[model samples]
Target: MRPRLHIPRPHRRGFLTAAAGLLGAAALGGCDRFAASPMGQRTLKLGEDANLFVQRLLLTPASLAKEFPDSEISPWFKPNGTIDPPDRAYKALAATRFEGFRLRVDGLVERPQDLSLSDLRALPARTQTTRHDCVEGWSAIGKWTGVPLSEVLQRAGLKPDARYIVFHCADTMEYAAGGEEEPETDTTANPGMEARPEGAENQASDSQAAGAEAPADEGDEAQGIPVRYYESIDLTDAYHPQTILAYDLNGQALPVSNGAPLRLRVERQLGYKQAKYIMRIEVTESLKRIGDGGGGYWEDRGYEWYAGI
Candidate 1:
């Protein structure tokens, strides 16, 4: 029998905390708008670049992330982000327990190859109990087993020009809904209500984005589009020993609730940086064409790209 991974129900206090967080989300939830705006995106990019520069200067090969003993692994590790990807291809793989799943390793590499589940397991593997920190106020320790990403990159023969390793994932976060009109607070009363209400344009855009349905909404996220989710990291983090494409968690085939098949476990960054439902690994020197041309899915939504903490 497959090992069972349990998730506990939140208590009353936890529920209240969640409710409070949701209320605060409205005022703080303009990430999508910030990502979409040319000015806003440029500003966020500067911040990302600055953060990356600082991290690089302080980071060293010897600066290892903290690890815990097996005894410290949590009794339950609740899945974050998209648990069951609604993608047809991902569904098919899950149906057969991902028997036919193959992780495509391409994008600007000298030796591009598709590594199957067995192929990944056959490679040298490292198992470590590490804590996953989420932007949300919660965390958990899980023992993950997978091959070091550096080993795979070495075999793939990374091109010298490749600077960033972009992770294309299967899970989509939102869909273009039907007739969900952008809420407009037109300030042009008789064409004399000048000045756009002081950032009215920005407010209108943000309000409309809030109406966008998440991927888990009724049926498909949208008509036929997949809710795109992806992330990117520097080659340095890609080659980090702790960074691995995990296929097994807690001593079992990675549960569907926690990114089955394969997922990127970027140990040094926040949970969102660990892109789940991993599909492809693209190596590019620039982030000019990766999903609205930002750094990651959340980053595209205005979340800090380099969530290194």
Candidate 2:
């Protein structure tokens, strides 16, 4: 059945906000040593599965997140996570107002594309005023404008085997030694997206568009390479009407602190799932090869992988 797209009613919106707050608190809290243990890990996984199952049962795949009117837009929308990326490539692009930036879409697709901001703007776009629920127990509403992720996927022509869409971003979570930052590198050597356009630099653009795991070591080796922020969603959510690559926020170009140039707005999920500074979109069959094999940067840190609300 095709998923229906409809704005959630006021009463239901209140219910969803409360429900999402409770879920985010329970799932995204700080991790302790217990969470790192094998037994505790299994227990957390069970909880995550229960949460996922319950949400799926309650909400249809096409269910739209509650949208608010412009009057209700938050006066101050707090930016969560890294506000500015320290990577050299990102800075270079930002220096030029992201003129040379391009969003690389590849992996498990018949046609890999490097879409510029103008290219994304030319595609069909959807705008919505929705609430952002951060796991830290804060909520805010803002208007967002961007291309539906489904449109981009259709343009790229997803392969039959594609099961998940992974978002590659520019924000570096961990820096190398001496505070030096490494340029963002595509996690995989997938031949499909390896080639860049002529004159394209190694960095990640603004039409508003939209890393590593290392072994522990006693010495400088512990620093490892810079690990950029990343998140993923199944094809179901990726195709949802509310899921978009947002380029504008609150009726203006998105601010850097708010994920300028581009960001992912997966409305049904918590804020952490909405990765900012998105540079590439990869359609993959599995998450095993990404970031400690845990699906996302936070997921590797013991957070729930499927944090649906």
Candidate 3:
């Protein structure tokens, strides 16, 4: 049964603001040490524990973030994070309008799933308008539609050992070295998608139209290659009623700039906490095994993992 495509918008309301800049900056200043040094790592662990305990203790587990009335929606909701993913595979999927895209749910599951775009949209879909508060002193309200994360997990048959849900995306943040150009996009790689128009520049136009501007640099790894972008949340937020794998923005198909095909909208937290361009859902017993022993790309860069609002 498809959940309502348009749940009645909630009453216009305000959400409490959290002071995340100072704390997040502090942790980020020493993010590498926070993960590398045994003492720093222990401190981070303590901080995460403190954050989780305090948030759960202070509020009901099912309490939801405020959902705004449709009248309150922002006319131009900005897409701040990775607007365009430079992956050849992802570009091919986008070229085809994502008919070939697949959302893989794996790791520590009774039945792993490889769901296509249609498969996900067919499931119950929930739409909500909510404020997205960015740590960088900005906010916007958007209506997001997708399957509740809990529903997907239920279908996956998660194991008791699962503690965190990791969102793997197609984007990669690679710094451009002084003179090296980023690799050109491969527009014709996937025969599934129609051939790119003359000089379309890989997936650039698609992403730009979708609200993302492709980077000018080559962004190739030989110059500077960082890990792929990813994020994770504990079971608590992962199972929240408002937490969803958002696929549509303001009733239309999600834009490439806004993490086309799929993204996560965990309403209770700050903006960066929402992962975009999601490709896979990996259930794991702990974050230690993931990249750099931190739960997310930003976490690996020294930002705190549990960013509660």
Candidate 4:
């Protein structure tokens, strides 16, 4: 039987206060445009150079939040968005208990790696029960166990030019119907979007293309599926002591609905930044070339790329 965990309401209030404070600061500084309603415009217009500078300035090793005795842990850790991915490949892996699942870590590194779940578990691990704060205004606390992202980067050996780490996910969002299909002539072509059911990916791709041409409808693209929920963190956040790739929760193997095989644990940011169904990690200098030049799937749709808190 699992132990009952308790999440204090006061902690939730504190988390909200901190988040609002950060968002408020961004707003006062004219950064609120990044978080503008996704249904309006779907792009971050901060420009590459300025965005890079901000990301650099925000980079800092994350300090671990204070921990509590085992008895104080939360009893229930509710699953976040898309608990079970609709992707067949992911479903198959889950059915088999992720026996063959592998995490590929590449890009801007001296050594690239393909690590299995067992391989990750064999490494030294860190465990902490921290609050999971969501952007939509909700929070939960869970005990996560995994190797520090810094440790993984060290093993991969980051190149000097590596400035950001991009997380690629397996989950693809379904968009509204209607739109023309364009052939993939370049890297920017939506790979995952194109693979979606007819009308879904095409509509999404068209909105993205349209958003690129006219910033007016960018909000529409934001309301739609934005490149499938990818996120990037600066080198500093990548090395934060609290930043981990969690594999366990509350002393047990991670549940399938809760990013069973593995998921990122970036405690300082909102929950959306903690991507699940992650398959690839790429190190890059700029997000301009990643997905629609927005740094993240959601960022491509107007969500802030540097979601600092």
Candidate 5:
């Protein structure tokens, strides 16, 4: 059964005024200071517990939002996070329309395989038009088409030790902590700042330019090396019928910015968990070894790893 998404309508001025007052108090009371101390960790843990409690009180389980009809869908669906890929390999793939792109499925599986776009398309497919909710307070609805992740896993033959699936992406975000570039490599292996196209480089120079572009729309058919943005979910979510490796939207191939060729669709969680530009899928028992011992790049910076809502 599809879960019903209950979005409370924005309250009028009275509610806003009251909420603002509370926010003002928290700000004045040294919210940042409390957030930085050991006491802050305890406070955050308590707050998270409260948040989960209140969320349960207000919204239905995400599993209920899984069912819907084609006629009722959101018209303007927006993409969230990492709209443009910065990796040179991804750019080159994008330039050629991802014709040579292949998705590598390995790790704790009986048959590690390198699959092309056509290979994935040939598998049994499923489509769903669903709402994507982000932690940053935005939402959009779009149609997604792809094979059930279960089918892929079954074909690959999961090893008994496989417990979590990890996504490795090509879309590397700028981590002020020197980003993902290997410290040992010199400029030769690393395409210096000079490697970027003139227009893209200019865009990188302007802060506003970064967020100006939205991800590709649902129907974009342009080919290129698909961008690299990977995400992962636990085995429980992996086998859900609603969880898929989407390749189409609005009855067409996914656009470049929208994760052309393939992207993950874990409907139970927030949008960030739904990784795009997926080139590889790895199955493992623990996330302790993946980026920074935190599960995900953002999680390393303190965002909750299990963002259930």
Candidate 6:
């Protein structure tokens, strides 16, 4: 049986206090409306760039996120986005306990390869207990175990021009119903390096076509179109000692609700930056062509791309 960490308290008031202070400063200084205008967006972009520079400047290879003892692990680490992917391919993998899953690591890397779950576990691993601060203003602490991202990057061998590490995920955010077709099938549980779903492109165009918004009706959701979830980070965070592709949570094989198979644990960033249900890690020189041309799923929707905390 897999081991499970017994967390007495899910919320650490003390840690939350410290996290709040850190986040208040790191949080975007501008409001949504302020970021809506061309000039305002430019200003916010500059602010984001400045924040990235300062954070990177202060961060050292030796510097790490605060790690807690077993006693401090939150009994309940709230699962973020698409707790369980509804995609047919993902469900098939989950049904068989992901025995057929293969994590594709490609893009600008010189030696592209597909890593099995066993392949990842065979590598040197790191375990860290860190707090997860969310952009939604909540926090939780959890213990994570997995191979450091740098290990895989080194094994694959980065190309000289590689600039960013993009995580392609198995979770699809939008899918249209009725006669609309599902995403092209790949026999492997993990998705291959394909373009975003057509629905996702249309959604992007539609949203861009109209800036005005109607207040959301309770429980309303767009149906039938498929947009896969994805996120990215620069080589700096990818190589950070604390950065890992987590396969276990709180000493137990990660539950479906908590990103089974693999998920990113970039401890220094906000919760949204930790892309779950990860299927591929693409080393890229630019973020321009990925999902709405932003750095991440949330980032494309106006959340800051850096999201450092």
Clashes of each: 2, 3, 6, 11, 17, 7
Off by over 4 Å in 1: 1-47, 176-213, 216-222
For model 2, residues 1-309, the per-residue Cα lDDT tens digits are: 222334233354544554555554466457576566675566556567656656766787789999999999876666666555656677788778788989999999889999999999899999999999877666778899999999998888878778889999987676445444345333321121224335533222110111333212212323556677888998878988999999888777777767778999999998889899899999998999988878888887767798787
Error of 1 at 4 (Å): 42
* Per-residue lDDT value at 189 in model 2: 18
TM-score of 2: 0.76
Model 2 whole-model lDDT (C-alpha atoms): 0.74
lDDT (C-alpha, whole model) for all candidates: 0.69, 0.74, 0.72, 0.64, 0.64, 0.72
- Compared with the true structure, model 5 gives a TM-score of 0.68
lDDT of 3 at 178: 36
User: Could you report the Cα RMSD, in angstroms, for every candidate shown?
Assistant: 16.1, 11.4, 9.6, 12.9, 11.1, 12.5
Tens digits of per-residue lDDT for model 3 on 1-309? Answer: 312222122222211112232344355765785557776555555556556555766777589899889999876666656655776677778888899889999998888999998899889989999999876666879899999998998888878677789999888654434335444444223222223346443332322322323344433455455356788987878778899999888888887877888999999887888888899999998899788877887777666787888
* lDDT, candidate 6, 216-298, per-residue tens: 21112344355777899987788889999999888778777667889999998988888888999999989999988888877
| Model 5 misplacement above 4 A | 1-30, 42-64, 175-230
Stretch of 10 with least lDDT, candidate 1: 185-194
lDDT of 1 by residue, 1-309 (tens): 211213233355644544454444444457777556775545545555555555555777436789999899776675666655556777777788778878888887888989888899999998988999877756879899988888788778777577888888876555544523222222222111112234332211111232432344333534555547788987767877899989888788787657777888988888888877787888887998887776877766667778888
Worst lDDT run of 10 residues, candidate 4, spans 185-194
lDDT by residue (tens digit), candidate 4, 28-135? 555565445452122223333234344444453445555667776655555555445545567678778889899999998888999998888888788988888766
* Model 6 lDDT on a 0 to 1 scale: 0.72
User: Which model, 1 or 2, shows the larger TM-score?
Assistant: 2
- Deviation from native of the Cα of residue 7 in model 6, angstroms: 39
**Per-prediction TM-score:** 0.73, 0.76, 0.74, 0.66, 0.68, 0.75
- The global Cα lDDT (0 to 1) of model 5 is 0.64
